[model samples]
Target: MHRLKVQGVPLILKSIVQLLHFGYHQAMSCLFPVAIFGTLALSNVVHLPFIYRYDAILLVLLGVQYFLYRSGLETRDEIKVICLFHLIGLALELYKVHMGSWSYPEPAYTKLFGVPLYSGFMYASVASFMCQVWRRLRMDMTGWPGLASAALLGGAIYLNFFTHHFIPDVRWWLTGLVFIVFRKTWIIYRVREATYRMPLTLSFIIVGFFIWLAENISTFFNAWKYPNQHQVWHLVSFSKISSWFLLAIISVIIVAQLKYVKARRVWGD
Candidate 1:
């Protein structure tokens, strides 16, 4: 029994190392979240529930995505702009916690005022990773209205939220206002990058689609429990999702407009 127990310890450690030391390729990392979801689905046979665990693992995929970023694909200045997005997002989260825009009654852990540090790191990392992947692959960013479209899209989403009584959180509203004002400022002061135009529009489109998928899936689960938020018309909820999608696109824009993103896959550019 002692020998058996000793042998099993190494096997457990090996499994962990394999999982954590996984590959860094973009396609593999992007699908990591889906693969985790599949495992969670399969585990139902063993009478195990895996909602939170899967979320954490999905977050870990993003944690790994961070190192994949390459220097050629984007500039140092562009990276600073990307970092600014995180600063804004983290500040918004702080407001959320402060205003009770959202709250955790009894979290399993408390790393940063009811939210884990990994929550911020994973999100910020994923943003940089995803943008770099598409930028590197030369994924058709051709001929999008670029900044103008971003502003219009952001405005439309914000307006919908304002129109609905469901938009109660002042912080959320102010957050939307921040992006709007930022875009206008980018247009005015950032003369060169502001007029440069996007290499592709689908980057934003694809991100938006993913956000919709997540929101729809959450609504199905009833875990998030949005109030009276149907697909057709739910003001605050719709605004929130739309805002997320728009903001991600705006991140791309902020990075791209600063000439941060560069096509690196070519033999030599």
Candidate 2:
């Protein structure tokens, strides 16, 4: 374990050196989008059956990473620029959870409040991968593939409210608004590029439908109970469809990002 820790320090130091090599301006642009998505995943790792209280305990470690990365003799302005994005993102996440759109159990044994810390850091790394892929493929394709993500997020929220599974008393409008803006933003970019709209629309539909099968598998496995056990299904577990879709989109987005990078090197970027 001591050797592992000593070895890990060099790797951590290496990442810092590499990130510093990136310079400040480039890092700032990519950080926000990365953090937004990463926290989403950390939320999942917390609940993984593989480890109990994995999410809560990770916060301290994540905090250390966050500070270490933001440390050294850096400009306050630049630090604030990165910090503000996470603060807002984290705040928004808190709001989203409070609204009952999602949740994590008590933090007594963990550091995460539904969203885990390393998860945010993890997303930051993935975003770096995505940034490279986006450069080669162009924003439209990355954003294009992401239309499915936007819908899977939007549709699940819609279903939650419609089914009366999760009620939103206040700030519910924010959820819909967030989805609309994201969807419209993607469409605006596509239309601006004068790309074919039909194919893009079809892609989202296909991804959405793709989630149904995973829901069936999980239902059979008893991995979940729907509507917080308010509504249960015996034939096939349909309760987790939205959450599954959300998870699916994240998985695909990351894989697509990696594949885009691999294809570029093979063909010579």
| TM-score for each model | 0.45, 0.31
lDDT of 1 by residue, 1-269 (tens): 99999999998986665444333335443542343334334432333244443345335544443433352444454355446655655655555555545433323332466543333432354456554554434333333345566556554544443443465535355445445444333221112122223323334445665656654553343212233543332424545555565556555555554442233433344
The models' CA-based lDDT, in order, is: 0.45, 0.42
Which has the greatest lDDT? 1
State, as a TM-score between 0 and 1, how close model 2 is to the true structure.
0.31
How accurate locally is residue 65 in candidate 1, as Cα lDDT from 0 to 100? Answer: 37
What ranges in model 1 sit over 4 Å off? 1-85, 105-110, 139-203, 215-236, 258-269
- lDDT assessment of candidate 1: 0.45
Q: How many clashing residue pairs, candidate 2?
A: 2
- Give the distance in Å from residue 247's predicted Cα in candidate 1 to where it truly belongs: 0.8
